[model samples]
Target: MPAADWWRSAVIYQVYPRSFLDSNGDGVGDLPGITAKLDYIASLGVDIVWISPFFTSPMKDFGYDVADYCDVDPLFGTLADFDALVARAHALGLKIMIDQVLSHSADNHPWFVESRASRDNPKSDWYVWAAQQADGTPPNNWLSVFGGSAWQWDARRGQYYLHNFLTSQPDLNFHQPAVQQAHLDNLRFWLERGVDGFRLDACNFHFHDRELRNNPPAALRDSTMVSSVNPYGMQAHIHDKTQPENVAFLRRIRVLLDEYQAIAIGEIGADDSLAVMGEYTTGGDKLHMAYSFNLLTSEFSAAHIRTQVEQFEARVADGWASWSVGNHDSVRVMTRWGGATPSPELAKVVLAMQLALKGTPCLYQGDELALTEADLPFEALQDPYGITFWPEFKGRDGCRTPMPWQGASAHAGFSSATPWLPVPPEHAARAVDQQAAADSPLSFARNILAWRRGVAQLGQGDIVFFDAPEPVLAFRRDLAGAPSLLAAFNLGGAALQFDWPQAAGATPLDGHGLPGAAEGAGVSLPAYGGWFALV
Candidate 1:
């Protein structure tokens, strides 16, 4: 692959800034802490390091609510600290990508403050503001993902403003060309800082229907399709988000990125995610790639995985995709898919399956150590979403806990001082120091990642899923001029046997370090096992 096409099949490691490492003894991870750990990140064999939002914010929704676009938050560190971190990551051959939350800004932002001062202010149209109906209700029936009505009434302007998340996060008005230009200038600010790319947060929510039309009710509701805890998914979401005008704004963003040879991956959360992903990334003039919450759901089965990948492939033409099973928002894959207890075999199988699939793979931090969600009490939770809907939903704090580096140290060596969130004992048992031992999941992940780096067919190939039994998933990856590779996995906990006539004359690839996998004329796989061979 050409140097310019690096992100096509690159393995990007996500670094949630608050939990990665704490170097300032402030019980929170900072930019300098990440700079100090570049060597360990490089050891994972990933091509890029995508850091979650660390921009200036009020911590309402962590760093997602941006108070300032051009500067770093004092809690995270100074702009100089960010520059040093980027310098160190580049020195270690790891490209850096920052999170860009372009959809909204914190209410405390200067623009929002000025916009709300009065309806006739210079920045009055900078945000989504509307007049109430005769009944004194909001303009529409839009709902916030965090909960309740999406509109918030502001007496200063005598109008309600839209907030798809917390009321503190006011949705920006993309209809205004000045708003779009200002955001593009912010992107240039980062590009000038030598950043390689950006992970667009809520990319589909950038625009809303100018008519302020109410979203139609959804026909059905399922936990797999949308969040069961929040009512935001109960709507068809036609007018509130994923507007047609978003494409033009994306093209403008692409033009700016092209000047710096940078790339962008969008996060699409909508009623029809696969179709939106196809539209957002097609024609190579919008986002370089896009990923949705399809694979992040709790559905873990051979048939489910096959359907998701195949449906995307069928719809997407000339567009690219970036796949991830876990990230900062969703529950960790181990507990969500691997059951309540941690399974080393299950972890290894999932790692291999994600890497073998076509597209760039993003591995969340501490997933290589097979970390599970931390069960936190209601009082211990910090997330506003969790606090709003407790007992039924505990929020994202479970997966956002500090990364455990040392098993025998206080707070799992995340910080000597009291950490923001308590480190679970179960997580400490699977710490980096403990998993460095031979045959551990950490060791298996290291071997699999290194092995994937050598196989072009696994990363940069077209995937075709073969018809296999319920418990087994088999796929063939074919790359131009490269030997095709066949990969199979047993997703169930019971031993399974699969008959594959295509395995004739195929050579088994060893040293992948996957456990309980054996192949012969056909194949024999133990519980939670995998097999890879050159066909």
Candidate 2:
């Protein structure tokens, strides 16, 4: 793939920095720790490595609250450590995409501190500040994604400020020209430092309603982005976010990225995320691609998966999508999609299905081992989101637990010291060292990825889904002047025998190691099995 369009169908491996590895035994993963694993990441045959935020922050919302956009947090190491990481990743032919949380900054950041200092300060309008209502209530009915009211009263300003998340992470005022320019400069800083691109966090939240209109009650609750228990889902979120002004700002970001030949994939959460995704990426003057929580939710079925892709394709003109089955924010796919008794076979099937889709595929860390979500005691929980929601909604700590490298080592070889989060013994059982067998999910992931490289249609072709039964997902990848590729996945546990008329007379393709066979129009698939052929 050419460097310019390399990200078009690239497979991205997300490395949550805090749990990837601990180099100096600090009980936390760092830049150097990631640097030490570049060769391993390259071995997966993935094209990009997206590292979550490690910026200067107090870690209130972990690293999402940025205090210094231009510096690495001491917990992760210094600027030199980041430079070395970039060098190592580039040497391994892997592009580095760091998280850019421009929508908000830590309240302690110099800009936010100064902005909240006094109403007459030079930076007073840098953040979203609003006046209190006549009855001493908040300006509007917008609620925080974390919980409670989105407005927090600032004593110094005698007014309220908007925070779509935690109060400490105050939303920036994109209406301010200076704020826009400042973020652009920050992007330039990293691009100059040899970083490949960025994963724009909450990209749609960059702009909000200027009039401060009250958001109406949601016609239907939206649990895709937040827990159903969260009141954040109760509102339609029309005025508070997904503003029209965000498009121009995205255009500016694209212009900046073009100058450096860098790419950007945005994270979108909205009332209509699919539509917003299409709007932002269609013109090609905005984000290169975008992903929503539609596939990341607890809903798992052949219909659910097919609908998301079809809906996104319908809305986009020429936009692309980065479909991910797992990420840091949600329960592990093996647990969420899999039943009480999850199977490694399901993990292999999920990987095959995600790769076969007509878009970029993003794989989360430790998922190759088919690691299930870790169950942590409430007292041991560190995530504030989970703590607030309590037993009803256990936060993301389950998925953010330390990666298990060795089954027999301390903390599963993730750290010499005690890890920030305890590694589950169940996860240790499926650690990288233990899953070295050819039949392991890790080995299957490698084989499938290597096989995908040789199939041009899988990488760059139009997708068409066949109407099959509930447990079976059948699709064909069509490329001009070449035989079409037919793929069918059995998402259920029971072995199945189905007839796919479209797959008649298709030639079976090998190299991808999965147990499935087809005879004319009849296909036989084992539990969580997949079949591939050239039709």
Candidate 3:
């Protein structure tokens, strides 16, 4: 792959800074902790390390609520620690990609603080503010993704400001040219800091309708982006987010990234996230690639996986996608998709399937260890979203538990002091030390990644799914002047023997570390097994 197109065939390993490792015994992971783990990340054979937000924040929504876009938060470390992390990551040939939350800022952010102080200040119009109605209600019916009204009344300004997430995270007014320029300047700061790329957080939420029109009721109940219990999903969200103005802003961002030969992958959470992903990445003058919440839902089926890829490929002629099944926000894939008793075989199969898709694959921190979501009591939860809606929806704290480095060490070697969240005993049993064994899922992850690097067809190929029964996903990756690579994954627990016409006369591709075999047109797969071949 060309240097500029390096991300095309790359694998991104996401480091949720708070849960990755703790170097200072602060009970929270930090930049130095990530720096110390560069070698281990490099060992995974992933090309990029997409670190989640470690920027200055008040920790309302973890680091997503940025207070200083250009500086690191003291909780994570100083800018010097971030610089050291970049240097170490580069030494290991790992490209560092940090999160850029451009849509909103912490209410305490200087800009928000200044904007909310008075209506006549220089930054007064920086945020989305509007006057209340005759009845003293919010300006509109837009609802927050967390809960309640999106509009928060600011007594100082005598107006309401929009917050799609927590009230502490105030939405930025992208309609203001100065706000746009300020964010651009912030991007330039990181670009000059020697970072390779950025993971644009809520990239589609950068713009809202200038008219501030009331959003209509949803044509259907949408549960993919927000929890079903939240009223945020009841509306179409037409006026509040995913506006067309975002396309231009994305182009502006791409131009800056092009100057540094840096790449960007946006995170899209909209009513029609796949469509927004296509819109953001189609022109190449926008995002380099984008991923959506489509795959992060609890729906795990061969049909569901096939539909997501096929739909994107059908709509996006010149765009790209970064497919991710696990992230900090959702329940761990093991528990969400793999049922009550998720096995290591399930992890291997999921990773293999994600890798075989016709896009970049992003792996979450502990998925390689087959880490199940940690079950915590209500008192132990730190996530505000969970605290608000306790029983029905438990929030993301389950997936944000500390990494288990050593099974026998105190706090699983995550920290000498007590961790912010307890490391589940189940996760401790599957720590890095134990998962390093030859037959472990971690080893399987390393082996498959290494094997994938050698296969050009798998990296650059057009995907075509075969008509297979439920619980079995079959697809072929075709590239010019090379044999087509055929893949079949058994998504369920039972061993399956299926007759696949596409696999006839295909040469079995081995060394992938999963159990499966094919003889002529007949294929056999163990529980959660995958089969690969070159035809």
Per-model clash counts, in order, read 0, 0, 0
Model 3, position 370, has a per-residue lDDT of 95
lDDT comparing candidate 1 with the true structure = 0.89
Better of 1 and 2 by TM-score: 2
Query: Which consecutive 10 residues in model 3 have the weakest lDDT in total?
Result: 1-10
Give each model's whole-structure lDDT. Answer: 0.89, 0.93, 0.92
Off by over 4 Å in 1: 222-226, 516-521
Candidate 1 lDDT, 497-521, residue by residue in tens:
8788777678788888764444556
Go through the candidates in order and give the C-alpha RMSD of each one to the true structure. Answer: 1.2, 0.9, 0.9
Candidate 3 local lDDT, 1-535, one digit each (tens): 5667778899999999999888888899999999998999999999999999998889989999999999899999999999999999998999999999999999999998899889999998899999999999998899999999999998988999999999999999999999999999999999999999999999888999988899999999888988888888899989999998888898999999999999999999998888888988997799999999999999999999999999999889889999999999999999999777887788999999999999999999999999998889999999999999888999999999999999999889999899999999988999999886888989999999999999887788999999888899999999899989999999999998899988788899899988999967788998988999998
TM-score of 1: 0.98
lDDT of 2 by residue, 60-157 (tens): 98999999999999999999999999998998899999999999999999999999999889999999999999999999899999999999999998
Winner on lDDT between 2 and 3 is: 2
Candidate 1 vs candidate 2, lDDT winner: 2
Q: Which ten residues in a row have the lowest lDDT in candidate 1?
A: 514-523
